[model samples]
Target: MDPLYLGAIVAIATILVLFSGVSVGLGLLIVSGGFLVIFDGMRSLELMPEILFGKLDNFALLSIPMFIIMGSSISSTRAGADLYEALERWLTRIPGGLVISNLGACALFAAMSGSSPATCAAIGKMGIPEMRKRGYPDGVAAGSIAAGGTLGILIPPSVTMIVYGIATETSIGRLFLAGVIPGLLLVGLFMAWSLYATWKSGDPNLLNGRSYTWRERFEVLPRVLPFLAIILGVLYAMYGGIATPSETAAVGALLCLIIAVVIYKLWHPRDLWVVLRDSTRESVMILFIIAAAGVFSYMLSSLYITQSIAEWIGTLEVNRWVLMGAVNVFLLIAGFFLPPVAVILMAAPILLPIIITAGFDPIWFAVILTINMEIGLISPPVGLNLYVISGIAPDISLKTILLGSLPYVACMVLAIVLLCLFPGLATWLPDAVMGARL
Candidate 1:
């Protein structure tokens, strides 16, 4: 059989398995192993153990668990609420201030957590009700947090960026820095839309908000500032060349635990155990997927499927931007069904070379891919953030949430276009700070 046809089969089979509600890691393992046995025989199965172990053995991959622990520790405490309240106090007087504050909280929490679902669950639980209590529309109330939560994958300390970095052999720190400007850009776009929507509606209740005293604004700072400090510390350590990603993550995780215990008094053994257990579950799931994806990539390579695809792409005479548009569309479709990490593990490798050959920077493309994933978070079928908002605000219908998110989705596409025009938004910070990488 032609390797291209086999590639199609693998693609279709993987999509079918994942959409059929199979666990991501287990599903990938099944697809890869079955293909290996059928095409390469039982003898090829021997390499599976080595590939799995070898993939997990990556030094940088160690950061994944630590980062997960950091997020778990924070979410287990009152940090998310405090963060939102702090922002709400500062932004209270502006039109659509409640929604704007929710987005600000999401971006800040994303820096701390790096997991979209965690960001949505924590901030949405607090932000949604507060916004609704203040007369914010249900769609805007729910949509804002859902959109904001997608920031988790684009900000520094992001798990998705870490996964992308390791998968592509790009510098994790560079990728982290790469995301900073674009992440902020996306937040700006979201808040701008919220402000415009509310102002344009001319609803006095949504336009005018409660005022907070200076002291009230300052109240939650003590609790929230430490988490912000951790985000800055992680970025500084990694970008300043003071630590590798794993080292920064290890220290960041420790700092988060200390802050959680000190500020929130969650020092009980049971609380600590819950944090550990949660992080362990998430970390294991990610690592298992990475290992499985390693074998999957290996199978594609062994079968010449990946190489053939690359060669086929090289022969295309289309404009570079056209190719990029097509790639983004493919990524969007894939992300609508699969989570960001799985999508990155499965697709980034295959696309990186094609992107570079087309005269695009890999780091800039990482930002693009991330924005696509962000769009997916609010999109349907597997819109995890949408479901998260649904759980947080049971009264709000999913259809309304999705409808509300459409504007923000447009914002994301706009961000992608802006990045394509500037490119520097994703690359400048990293290059400025670290010097250019080969």
Candidate 2:
């Protein structure tokens, strides 16, 4: 069979398998391995160890676990709770303050945790309940944080960006820098939606925010500032050429542990055990997907399917914007079914070459792709953040969470359009700070 037709069939099969409730990593491995054996016999299967295991041997990949630990350890503490309190204290005077406050805390917590579900679980546990207490509607209260949680992958020190960097051989530092402006842009868009929602409802409770003393506001800072500083330190170390991402991740992870122990008194063996256990589980899951993706990519490359597809796309005479739209639609569909990390690992290799060939900046596209993933986090089927929100606030039906999150989904879609109009939103900082890629 021609590689093109076979590739299309394989793609359809992969999606079907995923929808059947198989674990993503395992599903990829099974489908890829089976197809490879059938494609070229058992001899081809022997190379799996060299192709897959060798991919796992990357040194930069070490940063993944460290970053996971940074998020996990901090999450085990009262940090998310305190971060929400800090933002809540200040934003409470405004209409829809609770909603805005949750989004603000989510952005900050995303910086610290770099995991979407973790951000949602940590913040929603506290923020959602409070928003309900303030008489905020279900959709606005649960939906806001559910959408906000998607920030984890776009913020600095994001594991998803790191995965993309490693897969494409792009600079990790540049990817991190690339995400900063766009991440903030998404935050702004989310808040604007919150404010607009507040206005639309004309609910007095949204306006009647509780006042906080300056002392209460100042005190929450001590607990939250350290995590913020850790994020800044990681960004600077990587951008300023002071430390490698792995080294930065290592230091950030250590600081998170120290703060969790000293400030939050997370020193008990049971607490530490839970942190390690959860981090390990999440990290292993991500790494397994990456390894599976490596094998899948290898299958395509070995058979020339990926190159053939890219060449076909590149040869098309269609306008570049139309091509980008097609690519974004495909990414959005993939994101709806898969977690961001899995999507990045599976798609980046094939897409990066085509993106460069089309004269698009890979880093800018990374931001656009992350925004698409943000939508997926709120969208149905595999919308992980929606489930996270539903788990935390069981009273809020899935339909309510999905409906509330729709506007934020529109906000993310608008973000992608904006980044398309002004690519600088994703590129300016990286080019200015590190100089543009040749």
Candidate 3:
């Protein structure tokens, strides 16, 4: 069989398997193995163990599971709830205060969790109910939660960034550092959009005036400050070279455990076992996906698909910016049909090469790619965040959630444009800290 034909068939089969609701890892494994056998015979099976082992053996990959454990432990502790409550008291004087505070809380939670679904589950449960109780429109409540959930991918400890760093052989520490400014920028954009939406809608739900006294505001701060301190400590230690990314993650996980058990008193002794069990389950799922993606990527490389795609893209006479725009459009469409992780897995090998060929910084492009994925999470038909929000707020119709998310999506696009125009927004901190290390 022609290699191109084999590639086409494998791609189609992989998509069909995914759409059929098979687990992505299983789908990739099956499709890659089947293709390899058909094209290269039974001996190709020998490659599977090596591919899986090579993918999993990376020391950098250790950070992924540790971060997963950290996120789950933190979520189980209800630390996010306390942080949201504290933010609510402090922000009540502003218009659309609860919604603003929701974004703020999501950003704070994003610092710890780094997984979109986890962030949504953590903040949405608390924010949605509070927004509703405060008389905010259901659409507004749903939209805010959905939008806020995306912050997880943009912030530090982000699984997506780790995956990008590993995929491209970029510095994980630099990638994490690069995300901080853009993440904060997006959070600010979300808050501003919420304020503008409230102003335009004349929504009575927004709290106005300086209602909370200084004493009351200060009282709530103590509950949330420790989480912030932990986050800062992790980033500081990593930046200061006191820890590698994996070590930082381990320390973060340990601190999360201590916080859950001692400070919040939310996790019972029995719950520790549950957290470990859940973490193990989730980590296994992630690792399997990574390993499968590795095999699929290997198959692509063997077929010279990456080289062909890069050469084909290089032939296009368009300016680099135009090419990036095209890539963004392609990613947006792909995001609608594919899961973010799956999209990243499939696209990174192809796109990273093109990006490097185009002379763009991989770290900056990673941040940009992540923002696009965040937008994809809220996109119509297959937006995972929309479904997550709708699942929790079943009373709100999908159309309403879709419509409510439009403004936030627009803000994400704007954020992307800003990052493109000002690459320094993503690159500055990484350069200042990592210097020539990148």
Candidate 4:
């Protein structure tokens, strides 16, 4: 009969529904609605309409659809093929150069697209065949694409950052600014691991003893500069407060379209229609999740579960370091079973309050949490990246991709530990830029 007990049941039921193949939006709505009716009676039904409308009314949320359109459009237009070709020409001299190039291309594409699946699909299609033709091992090729793809969320213009900012009421612009350095750091780490792996494989012949001309190396730079320009333009506008997040997303989308149409001359009027339709579909799904998450988050608040959990964690005498380490472990475990978006939506509400109560910076926690999600992308069982790569290389078993990804996963874990030890890695830019404004 207790509200707390009933709330617990509803929460469990929600998890069951998700695991049993129900849509996340529908599961959250069903559970939240069930709790409202059982706990607050028929009078509670009146609140649903307003709650749903309020959740959808968020102006900042408009950025989601716009950015998705931009990413999908750029992706469909095959703009990244140019960047990959340029990178390949520059990196082709080294052993496992193509593999290393795959990582670089994915990182660049991620900065542009900000979606892991898109990054994986685009770069994988190009890189996998090249690497295979060049005698790279199947596992290595698959792992490289899968691991590199995760840079999408870690890099700027990231949908993950936007969603986290919306949930925690943090400045999305500041969060975007904060991710730039750390994302690049992870890319560097992955590059280092790829080089080391190549060296360890003992295939000096893989280098093909090839070298590029000075003129040729310099030539590719110009072709790749546009991708860099678009990313920097979006981030610069957001960081400078020259544009709001949604406005910047709109600008980025238009810029991507122009680049495809005018610069690349690859896009046509019909292509625009397809991009809009796909973006609308993806945006609607994300918005539905956001709306349902808002209702579920509201229900959690009404039940005092967040407050209770925060109070309990706050009362503990453990070191802050221990708490953070525990949070990383929790996130990794949760990622194995839940999708990254769901993991963030469900866990952030509960864990964030505890994090803030313990005097940790919310933005730093967001970065740390994002890294943990990256690990989940490569981890076995439910690693989405693994599946994405596997779909590309059906011959390579899921187990092999997971095994091959281990070193990159270690690199990510090390990156997280470094960031945890030196929170400045994550906080410095945000503070330097945002602090001056204040």
On TM-score, the candidate that comes out on top is: 1
Between candidates 1 and 2, which one is better according to lDDT?
A: 1
lDDT of 2 at 199: 72
Best by lDDT: 1
Task: Write model 2 residue lDDT over 61-135, tens digit each, in one string.
Answer: 999999999999988888999999998998888777788889999999988898888899999999999888877
lDDT per prediction?
Answer: 0.90, 0.88, 0.83, 0.82
Better of 2 and 4 by TM-score: 2
Candidate 4: 10-residue stretch with minimal lDDT: 1-10
Task: Give the distance in Å from residue 410's predicted Cα in candidate 4 to where it truly belongs.
Answer: 1.6
lDDT of 1 by residue, 1-438 (tens): 898798999999988988788888888888989998999899998999999889988899999999999999998988999999998889888767788889999999888988888889999998888878877777788888899999989988889999999889998888988999999999999999888877776678887678999999997899999989998998888877798899999999999999999999998999999999999999999999898889888988888888888888889889989999999999999889888999999997679878887888999999999999999999998899999899988889999999989999999999999999999999999999989877
lDDT of 1 at 58: 87
| lDDT tens per residue, model 3, 250-305 | 98888888877887775576889888998899888878888899998987887776
Worst 10 residues of 2 by lDDT: 199-208
TM-score for candidate 3, please give it: 0.94
Question: What residue pairs are clashing in model 3?
Answer: none
| Local error of candidate 3 at residue 198 (angstroms) | 0.5
Colliding residue pairs in candidate 1: none
lDDT by residue (tens digit), candidate 4, 1-438 = 555465567668877988888888888888888877877787887888788779888789989887887788678766678778778878887666777788999998987887888888888888887777767776678878888999988788888888888888888887887787899898888888777776677787765535778887787676568767988888788878798989989988888777777766655778778878888888888888888888888888877777777777888899988988898898998887776777787777888988988888899889999998988888877888888888877877888888888888988999998897888998999889888333
